[model samples]
Target: MTDKMLKFVKIGQQTPPKRDVGDRKDDFNEIYDDFIKQKAEEQSSRCSQCGVPFCQVHCPLSNNIPDWLKLTAEGRLKEAYELSQSTNNMPEVCGRICPQDRLCEGNCVIEQSGHGTVTIGSMEKYITDNAWEKGWVKPIEVKFEKDQSVGVIGAGPAGLAAAEQLRKNGYKITVYDRYDRAGGLLIYGIPNFKLEKYVVERRTKLLKDGGIEFVHNFEVGKDATLDQLRKKT
Candidate 1:
């Protein structure tokens, strides 16, 4: 009956076990280990469940932070992931790259009151990654059938997100990218220290599996002018 959130006082703060500086420096792999289930639960329980929830307020995507933290603490991972995905187009990616020290965790009420901020980003990542590993993650459902098709001009995060959303709503989506591969900026701009190329590749594969079309090495200006594509599509 006492199962609830706000256990920070009893639990203390913990980050994932980081690899040694020397070892991490020499490798391109992710430096922080994934939080084990017990550690993830403990960290999630540290949320103060603030009514105002500045953590959620500060998050650009306005994720329901307290809600998912409570779910994770209650060992309800599926619910946590669902709530997280409701607001974020890419929860796991944001969990890995978002500067939490300057955003959500920085605004946590308990952190202002002296306790270390709850490991919100790590907990978010854990919820989603565990969801995937457990087979809870599945292809997004088609909401409805639409005749009109949508053409997205890029394969970066924003364009990919738009394409996925359109496809989910039953619109045929075609993504055109100048690069030979999908994930324009995620592959070219971000280094492996922060994000791995395979993560982006897996997401692109998911989109392909869901009936979204991607045209790589196709240039809008060089290959076909805007007027040409508009006339074609």
Candidate 2:
């Protein structure tokens, strides 16, 4: 495992290929292409695997970065994806949207050491996308359903995360959103160049498939009061 790491001394940082500007002008789809398997492995192998992993520390979610990167270098992608998702509910979403330069990748130890920082965001994206392609990303399986139900207002990022966490703990979850769709800002605010609508749609679908319910196009203040929502829940 040690032999697989510390390759940043020899390897330069790299990200996924970008679509041709001429072709991109016509579509609202994502600009960066997915990293091929070989590239993902090679880039992942560049991790310094330092005693103190500043990348994980600086990440808002504090994900287990080095372990997953090591797993990717070792060709254990399922394990890598598992570790990545353990701390982050939506690795793929964060990979695409998170300003990693201001956070995780920015605080990388090797970047300060003069070797370019590891392509952490791209590696995270690759791991999750591969997991989705291989069917490793699955709906949560609750062993027991609790009697209590939770009402999450607004299907924005925080609300959706709260709903998923509650559902994981066996509570019945019902997400109420003003829009016709589940993802509030992800669907209406962000552009496809940064985050495709399908990604948010698929994640919301997974929550529904896991037995969570969604009440769309229902504004709380207009439709009902807080007390009424509580009673409904």
Candidate 3:
């Protein structure tokens, strides 16, 4: 443990090297390359392992930064990915689009100390991407089936998170969205560079495969009202 903590002190910070802005601007491919094994270890070793991790504090989802960072440094990537995903409903998605400069990376203790911040966002992306590549991501496991059914109004992030949690508890779910595609902002609103369409499609497919029904091109106000939906449910 002492050696682990000391590694942070010795290893200076580094981030995933980004492609030239001009080269990246023309296409929708991911902006930064995935961190190779050595690069990931180097980057993870930069975390200060602070007594108070401000990175976690400032994160919208409050991810367990230090634990995952330590795990990453130790090359226990699968455990790191699991810990990262515990707080975040979609670690892979969040790792891609979240504005780290304004959130977690911005508040990193090492960054505040004038050492460069640990590349938390890139490491997160690496962890989840690796997990997916290794087929470690599995479908949600429902313990028992329930009688009550739920109708989710949107296919956006919040709606999807709620649907996943409720479905895990065995609540029947039907998602209604105005757009033809299920993901509200994820499919249409976000630019391809930040998120590939297939990534969003995969999640939508997962929810569908999990047995959540989706009603597309179905506007609530036009097709039905609050009272109507309530009565239907």
Candidate 4:
């Protein structure tokens, strides 16, 4: 199995199949189809297992790409998802929007050798999407709840990521967003085709279910001043 796994020198690279441009432009749905079990394995098998992964070095968050790819190739998807999520606050979001042609996949060692780059972004999306479908994506599990609470002013990526990290550390988190939904740009700015609304909703729901409070349609200055919140907290 190990012998077969390191064959990027021989095998060609392949990415996920994308929707037709004309068809995809009509609506805000995912442009690419989800990787099938077999397809994901096949694609993962193209990894060169390089000694120094240029992909990891080039990644914004320096994710453990080769390890997670190996896990995915071996059909250990849940573990792969966890590994993928460790560094990335939003693997699914990054997978959807990240320009692979410019980042990790583009700098892949195998790609330099003309075998083409591993489809890192697509595989990431596959892992997270599979995790969600299988109910493997769970909320932050706090070890001990803290008495003190935090107020996150925005529901953007930074705020959400902060809230998740703090919640995991047992801090009571309260996210206040002006919109009705929790995700800031994720809910309104990004089109549905690239990232479906339900996917974002699922993560938000997990945070809510995990006891992180969300106050929607609440602006800091409009609903309550900074002074008022400071006193309340």
Best by TM-score: 2
Superpose all Cα atoms of candidate 2 onto the true structure and report the RMSD in Å to 1 decimal. Answer: 0.9
lDDT of 2 by residue, 1-233 (tens): 57988889778888899999999999999999999998898998999897889999999899999999999998999999999999999999999999999988998888888888898998998999999999999998889999999999999999999999999999999899999998888999999999999899999999999999999989988998898988874
- Residue 228 in model 4: shift from native, Å? 2.7
lDDT of 2 at 102: 90
lDDT assessment of candidate 3: 0.85
What is the clash tally of candidate 3? 0
Query: How far in Å is the alpha carbon of 26 misplaced in model 2?
Result: 1.7
Q: How many clashes in each structure?
A: 0, 0, 0, 2
| Per-residue error (Å), model 3, residue 134 | 0.8
Return the clash pairs for model 3, or none. none
Ranking by lDDT: 2, 4, 1, 3
Q: All candidates' lDDT scores? A: 0.87, 0.92, 0.85, 0.87
TM for every model, in the order presented, reads: 0.95, 0.98, 0.94, 0.93
Residue 4, model 1: lDDT of 65
How would you encode candidate 3's per-residue C-alpha lDDT over 14-124 as one tens digit per residue?
667788999998898878778998788777877778888899999988899988988988999999989998888788898899999899999887778777788888889
lDDT for each residue of candidate 1 in 1-233, tens digit (9 for 90 to 100): 33567788888899998889999999898887899988888888888788799999999889999999988888888999999988876788888889999999999998999998998888887888888789776766676768888989999999999998889889988999999989888888888878877778878888898889899999999999999888764
Q: Which number leads on lDDT?
A: 2
1 against 2, candidate with superior TM-score: 2
What are the RMSD figures for all models against the true structure? 1.4, 0.9, 1.5, 1.6
Lowest lDDT 10-residue stretch of candidate 4 = 3-12
Give the distance in Å from residue 119's predicted Cα in candidate 4 to where it truly belongs: 0.2
Weakest lDDT window of 10 consecutive positions for candidate 1: 136-145
Tell me the TM-score of model 4.
0.93
